[model samples]
Target: MTDDVQAVHQPSDLRTVIMTGASSGIGAKAAATLAEGGAHVVVVGRNTARTKEVASRIGGTAHVADFDRLDEVRDLAQRLLDENPRIDVLANNAGGLVSHRSETTDGFERTLQSNHLAPFLLTRLLLPRIVESAGRVVSTSSTANLFGRVRLDDLNWRKRPWAGGWLAYGTSKLLTNMFISQLAARSPIQAYAFHPGFVSTSFGSDSASMRVLNTLTGGSYGISADAGAVPLATLSGPTTVGVPSGTYFDQLKPYGRQAPQAKDRILAEVVWETSSRLVSIPSDL
Candidate 1:
């Protein structure tokens, strides 16, 4: 984070917030909270029926997009920009943990692409609009970051046999914070990243490896889905609430702790430059 980037606290107007992964868990709960407060919510999720149901419940806009496909992400960005003249908040919440190491059709690691690259590209594409609206971008990260480390050279783990599935998931979360750190340094948009703790949701039920890991670790014993949502909801609340830009939160605490590297300027630059290259955006452009 840079000193040039300052927090612009605005009055709490009827904010138009866009929350991804709104079909379930924390995203869905955040959408409900914002909408109940008279703000217009745009609910995004991979599932068609559930997303529509959630949108219907809050009278919000629902859009289906699979982050595994970059094409869908691009289309989503286009639709949001075209339909909504102003976007007050963007929640980069849709992500997953793959049980096995794999790459998307885009040739990027599944967990890394879904959790980090997709949101990076989305924020870059919508940055101008976000600046115009003086909006905030709240990203959902994880407390599993304690077990995470970033490998700039082997970001996708294509060169190593030691890369496990959980490693990829953890690295993605760490990378998200690094991305947010630099993003705040270079831009004036109010942005925040948070760890929602271990929420009790069927987040990785599809994977046998993940299921076994969850059982052994009692991953389902954490707080409820709604409890994990408070941090995000608080950060996304009216600017009058007073949260510093580029800060990482542990649950609802504004100045919460993060892995040291997540806040490293040198590492943040490397991650930002590497990400821009991966997305084909020149750093100096």
Candidate 2:
């Protein structure tokens, strides 16, 4: 058999996988790895050409949709289910820092909407399909989650002066983790959050702190996006069956202090409730 044929046939039974922000960076790497392993990846991104390029390279399909928009995410989820209902894995990997404290057309904070609310709605919309496949939902959190407080009083950051991009970005990731824990507790479908560590990717590169770090230390502490995608792919794979759901991992192993706030069941419920209200997701989902 030819390599091309093998690539096409390799996870022949693993029908579908969905990866967000898959046009570039760690998300793209995860899509490639999963595709090479024989999963039919549905690459979601903002750029049609870039998304198609990556999708073509992986012998997969591309769906262009911006994560910063909740309506777009809802449309993407519906289209994905209409095309292929039984997605075996949903990788919520699309994330990054926004340059300013902006709001989406839907009126949510840009970073918070993209990193947390978008995925939350996407997951809820697709929850039935994932449950049907008995598949895993893998979310890409960050080491920065450790620094977040998830201020419910200022869920939209309305009262507090927007401290910085990291503040919003970190809070979004922490919300992602909180959502995972809450989902795991209530639903049959398993969910997980993970930190890939500081890979030599474009993450944090556009930030003021990173600019200073780059200036002072030559921007040394980084690993390739390929390295960062490894553990993400593993958790999304079938090998992770039986592992406890809703736990956080760093580089494929369990990680983080599970800070008192992180473990707060009430907080997780509140976060999910607020998330559902903001995104208009069905409570049952």
Best-performing candidate as measured by TM-score: 2
lDDT of each: 0.80, 0.80
Residues 112-206, model 1: lDDT tens digits: 89999999988888888888898888899887666678878898888765344777787888888888878788888888899988787877777
**What clash pairs does model 1 have?**
none
Each candidate structure's TM-score, on Cα atoms with residue i matched to residue i, is 0.89, 0.91
Candidate number with greatest lDDT:
1
Structural RMSD, model 1: 6.6
Per-model root-mean-square deviation over C-alphas: 6.6, 4.9
| Residue-by-residue lDDT tens digits, candidate 2, 74-115 | 778777777774778899988788756888888888888889
Report backbone clashes per prediction: 0, 3
Residues forming the 10-long window of minimal summed lDDT in candidate 2 = 1-10
